[model samples]
Target chain A: MSSRIDTKTKILDAAEKLFAERGFSETSLRLITSKAEVNLASVNYHFGSKRELIRAVLARYLDLFMPAASNAIAELQQQHPHASLTDIFSALVSPLLTLNSIRAGGTRTFLQLLGRGYIESQGHLRWFITSHYGEHLQSFVTAVQASVPTIPRADIFWRLHFTLGTVVFTMASADALIDIAAADFDEKNNIETVIRKVIPYIASGVAVSA
Target chain B: MSSRIDTKTKILDAAEKLFAERGFSETSLRLITSKAEVNLASVNYHFGSKRELIRAVLARYLDLFMPAASNAIAELQQQHPHASLTDIFSALVSPLLTLNSIRAGGTRTFLQLLGRGYIESQGHLRWFITSHYGEHLQSFVTAVQASVPTIPRADIFWRLHFTLGTVVFTMASADALIDIAAADFDEKNNIETVIRKVIPYIASGVAVSA
Candidate 1:
């Protein structure tokens, strides 16, 4: 027999796909349940409502993402206490690339969902961040500040804001970009490639002139 | 006696604001006409359809943006001839920042509209871009390729993709960021501050290793 948690996950998986493709406003609860292959009552039983289910779908991605990111940064700090700003930035960004690369079928869907949250003006994800990920954000910000001491706090904050934008857009728009470029280019799916590409750009931006 | 062009402009302004705040799907033609203080017939008469009106609004911003960007790159090429990658990158980005900064009122609204087009996943903007800006995108991509020779063409394409993402998000989310960082940061109206902060970061990202 399927476990209760399995049913819940199935609902989340289906909802994530629907949300990624159709968006939050357009997607319906009925569609989510049907896609999950569960009865209508199961969704109500598991998530209570569509809004909560949407949160669950997002939380699933964040659950996988936040800890991986935190641990990656922690590991980097432990190993390279005196790492350069480029190293620290790489540490901060690499885990995300790793996570997306390794995850199974729904990883891309979750990324699309996350991208929607960031880009969507509905303010749903902002509320989620304030309530749940505030500490994670602070920790990330602190790591960035510690890594790049030359940048003023305000500038660090602004640059971080911009960095998040870059990351989200790149992940979400990869397919479209590939299409736009006529498939002439293929990005390697490795953390080193991302770091090699993103770190120097951002580091140069933040580094104080001699 | 308001000229027909005045009514056209009024419709564009209203459509831009409504589209920026609510998005293309959520916004309605009725709301746009109401906001523009024009009759419903004005919208259909002027733009043929709501989608076309949205395109018109975007065209105003891009029309200003494309020329300035082109002129900036042209002037830089003429002056430096042997300009470094960073110089060329600055020429490509600075014009957009300058155009984004000097414009007031409706232009700013139109910018927000352009940002929504770039970031939103509904594919509304994709259709618009393919139809309207296909040639301009090729031109910009060609300019970026010329500027950064050391980076592999594939890498350059991906970096430029991320750069556009970052730029669009910066413009779209500036208000939220400014609000969050309000206590410590001085809100500068100067465009140079934006250019200085963003260009180096993007340039370094695209810079060829020595």
Candidate 2:
């Protein structure tokens, strides 16, 4: 790859790792630069600001994950026109797993970064995601709504955010939970296991009657 | 309150607000002292360390909520030995709301501090809670297990954590979600409304078949 591309990639890699492990506001530009082995000027020149850099870091994963997820949902609908909520949620599993091939621990890292963004950014990141990926999100929400037709629209809105919390917070703390489970219950788990484990819980939660 | 007690309360009041708003790591002793209008020496004298201070902030609420919650669960089981999982989870609402009587916005602030504690402090705070309050936790878990005897113990473990993520993340961003709901659906909500809505979702989730 070209030097400029290499520089940008390096910064993103460092930023994503720090942002996921630490947090958005807690991770400083200087720390990122030091880790990326690039000067402050490179980050400034490439991303313009810390906020943009954070967005770029997330956009890298969302750009790949969002359309892929939407396509997966579309395929599921075509295959089973009357798919259940669980089926619809399960359809995204493959796309989420595909993130692992893009980078080592990509799935967990992306999710942790997302959890940090929502919890720390105070709605800026939420707005960015909704505005940028509203179509994809809307498609997913519509699929969910159709599956649980009895649930009112406003209720679906709340349940979806509840679902977001379940997935994001779980993934952000996946490592810790895994450790506890292993020590306490002697059950081994990975990202895939954690994802599969949460699907039923959230699907059931979303579909439950008011 | 005596002068010494006043200083301790002052530090805790300021610390909890900042920790809930910004985060645990992001908020420093200096900032907390400044906000509390107390000297750093008083903070050290009372709490001994920042970690202890964070624990104290959470413990203040947990000290109240845990026993009350456990008592609520016991009462529900006493009244209806076969109470559903929804009943068990719903029983928490009263004890949680009692927090509001303790302080302004206590319910939201306590839950947010918890989310921050779990997400920001890594496993330290988790260890603190489980170790310090294991009896209360076990009683509640046993109540849940009795309600859903079909689900394995290990699965219950995972589902409970998933429920934690859902409630923690939801309450942490409760303001944002409430705003979105009001804007999009013209529905007004308060902390209690959100809590009631979540009980059904989580109760169904935990009781659903694996």
Pick the TM-score winner.
Answer: 2
Model 1, residue pairs in steric clash: A201-B205
Give the per-residue lDDT digits (tens) of candidate 2, residues B1-210: 334558899999899999877877678999999988889888899999998999999999999999999999999999999989888888999999999999999998998888767766666888999999999999999999998998999899999998998998888888888998999999999988999999999988888886
lDDT, candidate 2, A1-210, per-residue tens? 435558889999889999888777678999998988889788999999998999899999999999999999999999999999999999999998899999999988888888767666667899999999999999999999989999999999999999998998888788888998999999999989998988899999999877
Could you tell me how far off, in angstroms, the CA of residue B58 lies in candidate 2 after the best superposition?
A: 1.4
Against the hidden reference, what TM-scores do the models get? 0.83, 0.92
Candidate 2 Cα errors over 4 Å, as ranges: A1-5, A21-28, B1-5, B20-31
Q: Which stretches of candidate 1 lie over 4 Å from their true place?
A: A1-8, A22-26, A37-52, A92-103, A179-182, A186-200, A208-210, B1-7, B21-26, B39-50, B89-103, B121-127, B186-192, B208-210
lDDT: worst 10-residue window of model 1 chain A = A186-195
TM-score, candidate 2, first chain: 0.94
Worst 10 residues of 2 chain A by lDDT: A114-123
- Which tens-of-lDDT digit does each residue in B1-210 have in candidate 1? 344558888888778777877777678888888887889988889889876777787888777777777677778878976676667667755555555564554434555676666766366776777576677677666667776655677777667777877777776665566566665676653334554576666666566352
TM-score of 2: 0.92
